[model samples]
Target: MSKINKKSMGQFFTPPQIADRLVQLLEQQVGFALDLGCGRGQLGKSILKRFPLARYVGIEKDREHFNHCANLLTEQTIICADVLEEKALSLISDFMPVDTVVGNPPFLEIPISNHLVLEVKDAIPNFLSSGYKMRSEMLFFAKSLKQLKLGGQASFILPKTFFISEQYRYFREHIIDNFSNISLFELPSRIFSGAEVSTCILYFNYRKTKNQQLTLGCIDANGDIENYLKIDSAAAVTRMDFSYHRLMSESGIRIEESETIGSIGGLIHRGNMSRNELVRKSVPHFHTTSFPINEIEISLDDDVKDGIRFGQEGDILLARVGTRCLDRQVLVTAGKRAITDCIYTIKLPEADIDTVIASLSSKYGKLWRQINAKGSCAKYLTKESLLNMPLFN
Candidate 1:
């Protein structure tokens, strides 16, 4: 494919080495594998090289790549069509009882309605349908699974955010519900070609299992696997409880009647200012995209003037919605600029905003993990959830 066409399709061809590594992982899992979004058949060719007799099905929407190598493998079939197309399902079924499904699908922004970029929505059926959306490259994982048999397996490279992101909570929940074994190989930002998108390789085992425990492993950018993190049948519920307990304990605060002095609603207001406009008006606007709080340079532009301003002295700024990690409550007692709308401004009465800023910089604030819960790049912090965030009075 020409460079321009590939860029338009968001096709970042996987290097032979990376494709080989991913295919090697799948080779260890199953015999028959389906490569969704199989651009140029890089991954499919690698699969055939290792498993010479492997039943490989390479699905590509691009006509250029599909027609070039129709008969490259010993037992591989290349299908050229939209994956979301209804006819694609039948073709996939023909390869039924698939052992492994793998691919690196396109990644893009969320769609509000039927106004999506193309057939990308078909990648993850339930995400947009359930009112949850984000920029995801892992859609191949969810879609490819539909083509697999009961005890099939899947592997794919997806954006790294899926592991720690809150918008992906439902995505994570879905994986846990459907598959029993899920292993993740986290890579640093420099792994992929033409794209610095931080990503991970997810290994999914789709046994005839029902809500089985999952095994998770965190891999570094250089391909070093850390210890595996396992979760049993009750992983979801247990994770929630552990998260709450860990967050509360870090604050050195207990949930008690006496401890509840007043809700955050009394002190915090959703800060409002356009991100681009804020940048035009001022250099720093207590923004999530630019300044995520942990590394904001102390300046005059972030301080509030008189009432409900973006950056102001003694104003605590919290990202109300965006990626889960950035939803953190940040304090800007020194900057003089205004905050963007994505952030909420906390103005306390006779309070030390500096202390609040200090508190947010602590491990307790990091444990909240709510600020980074919504958006694709950044998990958005919901307004309601941030209101309930633990804060020391």
Candidate 2:
């Protein structure tokens, strides 16, 4: 156990035991490593502990935490600077040719254009006032690639959503072509502190070569690492899935990239009805809450204004609030109006919306409910997550 570093950027420091396991997996790929955005030096310290001879460098921007790292610094090099800033990166390369880069980058939201910003602010306050213009974590990945030499490996723990989100599609495609190997250690929500954000350790080598070993560690609630390609299991190991081979294995599967459907594109949108309004129009408004969902009563005097305002007939309605509306399905009509900020409206061509909704209502939808939904918690399902859904179609 460790005291939480509230002032520390991002999530709390990963517990020592988990830190040890992460380092062990990291070291199996590379000896020398850099810890980007290291806080309190726990991860950097763990690496040095396991591989006493391996060189370790930690970079932190916060002066207080940097002092903490410097106070006990031994065997590892520690520097205080913001990695996003050019000066910090220059200081880092002095210790360069870093075999690996690892850390949990900050979760700052990127700003979107005002048109979208206005739309989101009406529903999502957590979104930056300007909305997120660029993804902070993805920026770290881009910077890592710039820093690393060919064949150099980099690994970091990131929100699992990044793996499936449309926002990260470019990163994935670029890495697949550039990196010789890529491995994912998907961590379930139960492993972390209070935060319920699921994360995964993505490992990849920058160099391109033939005949590379692609290893994947599918972790579950426990910190189990089940190497599907190797048939090896860690202490908390659960079932594993993966095959060692080229980019596309002989799963005998083909998918049309263009035909792919996003939940948002499938007529799924956020639900943004406020509570007072929902209560007042409980009958006429379509709504779902953190509590069980309810149908709104439409009185004889219910106005057409209360019905659909933004979407037309056949648009799909998705609960837009935090985890409450996740996986909740609805059809949009001129008659169905949303009241809660948690609800979003998804509209598609009249010809395709019904088919898409039907698909979303099937086994895949159930799978989504089980895999992505955060149960009753206040989890925000961004359009990125719903739009990046994986399917055979």
Candidate 3:
């Protein structure tokens, strides 16, 4: 009955409406269902209502939630253990050939525990072979795929970033290549009340076939299912395809293969100056808030020369911290300036800087950046991601 600490357990219980919607997307008859990270059985409850006689198994790591599920859902089998353990796959497979795997897996990055990481690495070697770190939800997706029968299906509520993030490109490739009937249901508005990140429900079958077409769907604010867009599986694995899908779904914009800022001789890199060293030098430096940077004073000492990011006139400064700040574009002019690491100093001549700023500040440019930016509370862009952004001719 106590409030669950979502941060510690990474547990975000699905709302009743969202749970019911996910259940409705499943095939009419499900012989057996596995709830991978069932919080307090909301999703299980919904599934049972839809398929009254379906055999259900719910896994929960937190004792409080496990006990709650046990007390509330007496008819279903609930287990208490970390789902990422080595024995979990075999234990679930003992039930053999699960028809449906459903639940919103935890999304936070697991704490730095070597044993847990190794267990996951051993269990899902192919998913982790990209050398990019794995998230708990990514592991669950792989585990769910492994647990299903050839024709079984999986419906998971996942962060929107899972589809397009550079770090998850390998995982996306795996899903595109190994799964069929790959459908994405994007909910632009926040479904989970307190969760900051936007979410989408992904439904796909375990069957792998070449040249499968992906179905994309969206739920408007009124909960109406919009028309679906079919994309070729070959294109689905590319970054631009994902970006185009999101833009079309959310904003009705279609992006074509075009020249990017990086191609135009513009270099986007993080400000490498140390804040502490800036203060020690007692120089008048520009932070992200110091906009329209015209004049600034600095010591030419060896420490300052070696430590701070010195910017010349005609450079563009972008705030990389919060969403509001990220939208603000500052043009460096008049005098040399030392910028703090909180900002990203773009090195380009005045003409290119002006063009890039005008494009990035435009509607489509902002949309592109928003699609690529990552983070929950304060979204931000990495240097590579920024440089890779499409630049309109």
Best by TM-score: 3
> Model 3: runs farther than 4 Å from truth?
1-4, 87-94, 111-125, 130-133, 187-195, 218-228, 240-257, 273-283, 290-307, 349-351
lDDT of each: 0.60, 0.57, 0.71
Cα deviation of 379, candidate 1, in Å: 8.6
- Where model 1 places Cα greater than 4 Å from the true spot, the runs are 1-8, 15-18, 27-29, 67-75, 89-94, 109-143, 158-171, 196-199, 208-212, 237-313, 317-344, 348-355, 363-393
Model 2 misses residue 200 by how many Å?
1.8
CA RMSD of all predictions: 6.4, 9.2, 4.9
Ranking by lDDT: 3, 1, 2
Q: If both were scored by lDDT, which would come out higher, candidate 2 or candidate 3?
A: 3
Measure candidate 2: CA RMSD.
9.2
TM-scores for every predicted model: 0.66, 0.65, 0.81
Candidate 3 on 1-393: residue-level lDDT in tens? 333568555666787877888888885388899888888999888898999999888888788889988887898888887887777555566686688989799867754356655555543454443333457786676676567788888888887777766656766787877778888887654566556666788888877888878877776554457656778876677642344575655544344556667877888766676666677878767676665433222222222355567665667777776665666566655466677777787777556776887767776667776766777777787888778777643
Candidate 3 weakest lDDT stretch, 10 residues: 295-304
Best by lDDT: 3
What is the per-residue lDDT of model 2 for residues 346-388, given as tens digits with 9 covering 90 to 100? 6676777656666556655534544544322476555654665
* TM-score of structure candidate 3: 0.81
The residue-by-residue lDDT of candidate 1 on 117-219, one tens digit each, is 2333453444533354545354456567667777776778876566554555666666666666566665544565655555667776675367565555545
Error of 3 at 324 (Å): 2.4
User: By descending TM-score, how would the candidates be arranged?
Assistant: 3, 1, 2
Which sections of candidate 2 miss by over 4 Å?
Answer: 1-8, 27-31, 110-132, 190-194, 210-217, 226-273, 281-286, 289-325, 328-363, 369-377, 380-393
